[model samples]
Target: MLFIQNIYLNKFLIFSSIIYLIYLNNCVYSIFECAPQETATFVRISRARLDGTPLVVSTAGHDLTCSQYCRNNIEPTTGAQRLCASFNFDGRETCYFFDDAAAPSAGQAELNPNPSANNFYYEKTCLPAVNAHEACTYRSFSFERIRKTSLEGFVKKSIQVASREQCLSACLKEKEFICRSVNYNYDTYACEMSIEDRRSKPTHLRMTVDQPVDYFDNNCLNRQNRCSQQGGNLVFVKTTQFEIKYYDHTQSVEPQESNCLQKCLDSLNTFCRSVEFSPNEKNCIVSDEDTFSRADQQGAVQNKDYYEPICVSADLSSSTCRQQAAFNRFIGVSIEGQPVATAQGVTIADCVSLCFQNLNCKSLNFDRTQSTCHIFAVGQANANVKKNPSVDFYEFNCESQFGGMALCTNEGIRFIVNTKEPYTGAIYAAEKFSTCSQVVENAKQISITFPPPNISPNCGTTIKV
Candidate 1:
């Protein structure tokens, strides 16, 4: 028995020395040693500067002498105290501090054979000292183990999740969780998915594990009232007449919605606000009314009761306008610096119309001051007023043709005809016939001698003339 006692003493001394060293480094003032009657032991330091305010200390085994201390303070009062009834572990008694200032009373320690039977052992083996700069050890537990009688508003529902992916997907599907972090207990697979405005950050879903399971109170599903609610079949909000409406800038000018959409895509200006188009009228209206208000209806125009017209106030003079060119020779339609003819007097509109009518005219320049016209008959229209100048400018009329026939080339070959019918024969002569003999035929009665028939049959018949 003596030998065994000595061996235990040596072990206790060694353990105490290690605790002293830890106190030195961590600047802990108070230590708590607790061994619940449970299988896994738990030791805690009630007050330690370097040691977190609540610290756990336990030997690898249940052997005692895990003394906790404050720096340079041997005031037995400053030393660690026992918690619960002083139950002897192995042979030595476990101690804990009641408060930071009071001395530990050995008599007050009672033998606690059973500290609450339901006490759980968190698997965090390393009890780190709390520092202002350091992060506290966070315990994660599932809702199943956590005792919850009731929850307040804000947390609406609690559910057990299989994986982190399921938790995240659930949170995403819920519109209420627009901004909030999701806390999960991997042990219980219970998730506290909070719905908050700041939940957009993904860090809320992070999950870490300590060795042993811990209990977590799920406050995510505690809320009585939801952030948003679903109505019966309607799923829409009621609006007043003062609600403002927005539209696209090209909407008024486009003949159809499709055309307006296309124009919006093609426009270079980014300030275009909304588009309004009418299919019946084939008109599109594009406007920039950013600060439009429905209440301010004085200057607004109402169109067919469907839309209110916000005035498109723009400076017409400040608009970037181009003049039409009138002459061809003045500005070569193909090559630069080539001589071209100047057209006669014509207005800018008339010049454009003429250019549209002429098939060969690419563009024309009409001079407002001189009333002169310059038409581009062929090639690209390159007319500049400052340089090889023209008056006004217009693009050429290029119409598509079939086969090799140029429909717009000239006006001569405009029509064609086809014929298909049965045929009948008829003959007519218009001249009189004449005789071959005239006065020369006076010996008309003159007979011509004929050769006598040769043979015996002819000799009898010979006498007649």
Candidate 2:
């Protein structure tokens, strides 16, 4: 116990020393402004390989598990379990963890676990939780039709999910087609996505009443950065410092005010319309309803703050004076630069604002540990760039002439002259390409089929291979 105490004491001393040094020098503080704790997902299965047999599948949280259980334990969400190895495909990165048990029940009666497949496959997903804008956009649902149905568009093939919430989340993660609406069937557990004509007039979507089915519209779904702050700063009121008549409902425990708001917004059980936080007590009280007529729980108030979240009203979303790239930050990615200049005694937002204000500063890194803001002149978007856990990277959301659009170049591409598809970039480019680049591994090339550019110089452009 003494040895353990000493070890902990040493660690604390070292950490405190670093923080003290940073504070004394007015250097960058290595603390993240936002806590984007994503829900980690992983699967535990019965076999090592996909052999046209039913695999016994189980799921465990990223936080609760044995290290050996996960095949790809390096990531927060990964698993393998006792006998199986999680195999990741080369180009697709699909998870295949298992070997055929080949018991007497291999092909006998129907398989216990239904989502059986001959090949290993997993769907890639993109969530709107990456930033504030995406969260705001995806959650802005115009209408939810209970017991309503849409007979148009494709029904998701393969495994049937459990709940409507799960169905909605799955739709949000779709990389292709913008999922405008979803119809969840309780009986079949079928989750169907639609981007059809009904999506045009979402409010006017034709509905056939089906008791077991529920349809929901993605109101502000893909509208990214549709509103600007217009120099209107959000007000954060410190009410806990003074005693007031208090509301009683306790939402959840959070470290900071932002965490409380984020938790409130993302909650599934109850809608969190407002938040009241106590800095001294470290307790967060959330209101599920918008109305504040009832202060159900009161008294014994000690240094708590009440936060009304309607500062940046949704009215700004539809406002015509919205700035295209006013204030935006991609959470996980960091912009690269050598840091031509550095400063101190500023917040991460201030650092971002500094970069946004400068025409020359393309990308910048705000050192959280050192408390220093470093500016960069040029930093192009490179998805393959490695991320440092300690640094907070900010890039100015400049309206790209090409809209930050680039084709992803990958292995095993055959097309050369693509005229029909307006834009066909690489699905996943391993390395950067210069000019209309294509796959040419060694001396051999994809079977070339020559074609001419249509419509004289053509309205847009075409690739000739």
Candidate 3:
């Protein structure tokens, strides 16, 4: 019995010695692993806060305290933005920074005077192998809200969500249908995904959706070139039905609408003038030849979808695409459309392009807020030209090309014409028509831009897009 007791005592002593040796060698650590990564939210929160605004960021690094991490890392360029690191989910944390036109958002971001030790573990996130921005740029996300929106149709699919961030994760992971827009319902935590072809539909900015739901654009749109697609490459035209007035059908029975359009575009014999799709039998009619004149769309199925590559270059928003300013200075009044060649979302450059593209366009009205381009026939003279508050009427001001009008105008100056971009001073010229025109002749395409206003006449003169 004594020998057995000694053996047991010796084994216990050996174990204690080994542990002490390991401790002396600094091989042990006191640490807490992350409980578990939760979902992440995609809000465009502003950094400017009156008080206690929280910033949520994902960070990770070994032996990193929040204060040390910020000082050693992301400090110089961004300033003392690293206020406090609070865990949200998906390794995201809340930090503070100054704010942007299209900046993202944060919720429950406002910091608390004292965060409970139980609810949050105040530890820095694990750092990526590379820097934060580089890794973040490589990441993709969806624009789902803790809030929600709904529609009977146009929804590609739906996903279950634990939080607003989780729904965004699912939407980002979607494989099919270019997911540009998402509607989130706060009550049900349902995220409805939508793939909108802005070519046929409207940008979410213009879409008047109801409440209890919020709309997010293709997360890429917020980051100019992130997604390869947002605004399309080709010029946009209205969906209409057309009947080939002169050409004979190559196929006795019309082919599918898509096939027909492709056949025309691919035809070696002739350039596809315009495409007319018939929904009744799902047929398409391709024009045999191109018509550079205004009469091309004279008499067709006005009720269905029509598409034409009418621009000098199909790259409508390309920076290198040059445009000419049609009017010198027509302030406040509008020139009507070319009987038929009316277009919405027209910039000054686009206005010039509209007139230059259609042989029939004699005059045009470019609205600042509406971004609309109205091309009209020259024959329709301004016989009874009246002053109107809604538009900037463009007319030839060849006599007094005084660069641009000032705060005051001459008595004969029925309309004030601006040859450049619009500014606050332009608003002062109330009595005169603000004939606004963009310098499209040497229009340089600039890719960087803020999201435009949601109203009509959606195009601005400064940048072509």
Candidate 4:
């Protein structure tokens, strides 16, 4: 028995020594260095008091404490006691454990303060490998709300690139560039990159504001200089034009094409002339004219399609001659099949005003016969009126007729009379019409002098003195 005891003691010593050495190397004192079970549970108590004051018991960082304490002694009521025992602290507040299971109600006291009293509840979650010596803690994070008006400065720049991808890349490389939210095609494509002024942040401003900024430069050249070399050689291209009409009005910028149109359509006082999209960047060249042009050649690339331009014409009568046979009349040109709107009850001035207020109205056609108004919603309506018909009126939508007025007519006619060689005669109607030699002679030579009141119906035939 003694020999067996000695052998057992020796074996035990050797095992203990091995464990001690392993523990010293790994810096572990517990029998099992396993991670704690992830869990979500509440710690509940009844009638918690501090300094004789009724206190509200709360859980914070794996510990239970009183949130509200009084300086004087106060007994907790039954209701307060119930609330204290029913309140629950989310497992996330205590440890890294996430609440994967259904949360318990405050009424369920048994489930509120888990019988196990473990701050953590077991839950399945992905665990990233962590360095043994590093401490684990929650990271502080935040989010920012961005808007269009907040990024006007970065968008106003003239961005030039060989392709849309290059344009996007350039914006990404800019220091203050946040993202491209709005792009206006002013003959050339303008891209707006949004960026927050992080210099306002204390950390960034203190660090460095003059750091070398980086940006991508395509130099407006493609992989090959075919476009520059060709020099306006009828490249089958599509283009876009942006017109800023009203900046603060509901119909300011109007997008005529693409889903990106919605951005301008919803903005105040923004209007876009047209958009031209192509599969190849070499197909189109940005120009100074606010117009989009396309080549006649078809199928230069696959899926390359062009949309017709959306023309806006405010009023047409102001640019045409107005005559009155019975009712007010005006003769204006139309774009062949473009539709027009006409007003009759109102004078030509009022008619034009109405046309300007309508969203879809492009032109006007006023009929003198019935004194009626006709508003053409689309610009593709047929208008073929001839001979200045008494019932027919026409107007054309000029490109420059956006949110402005144009001169239609002037109220005078010039006439010259020549009596002999080296002699000329001119008459100023304003001063001579009332007391001219022809008027006085015609009055004296009249056959019968008619009463002034009777000249209403027979003014031409009857002379009035």
Return the top candidate by TM-score: 3
Per-residue accuracy of model 2 over 1-465 as CA lDDT, tens digit each:
999999999999999999998794332111101124422122212111334432334333211122123222233243332332232211112333332222221211222344322222221111323332333322212223333556454443323787544576665555555665677777788878765323233233446665566565443332121112132222222223322242234346788766776665455432344466776666776643222222322333457655433233212221221222233333334566466657675545446545433435566676655656877776555423347655655554442211111123332223332221234343222232332344433321123222233522212245644
Model 4 agreement with the true structure over 1-465: per-residue lDDT tens digits? 999999999999999999998885354212112235311112222111112121343323322211111101111222222212222223223222111222221111122222222222221111122221111111110011111112324433456654333343343344342332323232345544433221111122122123322222111121122122222111111212212111111112223223323332222211222223333332221111121111111122253222222212233332222211111123332223444444545433344444553434555565544556666654434445445344334342422112232322232122222121232222323443333212222121112221232423222223433
Model 1, 1-465: lDDT tens digits are 999999999999999999998875343222322123211111221111111132333322211122212111222333444232111121112223122321121122222334332122121111122121111111111111121211223444567877533453344345543313344455576655554321112122222344222223221221121122321110101111111242222234554545653453333322222334454565654332222211232122334112221111111222222221122222212233332445455433334444333334454555545766665554443543344342323343233111111122121122111111221322111221121111212221111111233422212214343
Candidate 2 ranges beyond 4 A from true positions: 1-181, 184-191, 195-250, 253-255, 262-465
Candidate 3 regions exceeding 4 Å error are 1-42, 46-50, 53-153, 197-211, 221-231, 234-332, 336-338, 342-359, 366-373, 377-388, 392-465
lDDT of 3 at 75: 45
RMSD of each: 40.5, 26.5, 24.2, 29.6
From the highest TM-score down, the ranking of the candidates is 3, 2, 1, 4
- 2 versus 3: better TM-score goes to: 3
lDDT of 2: 0.40
Off by over 4 Å in 1: 1-342, 379-390, 400-465
Native-to-model Cα distance after best TM-score fit, residue 342 in candidate 1, in Å: 4.7
Model 3 residue 421 CA deviation (Å) reads: 35
Residues 287-373, candidate 3: write the lDDT tens digits.
422222223324445544554542322122212212221133344565544344677864544555544444444556666667776
The segments of candidate 4 whose C-alpha lies over 4 angstroms from its true place after superposition are 1-257, 263-274, 278-289, 292-465
List per-prediction Cα lDDT, in the order shown: 0.30, 0.40, 0.39, 0.28
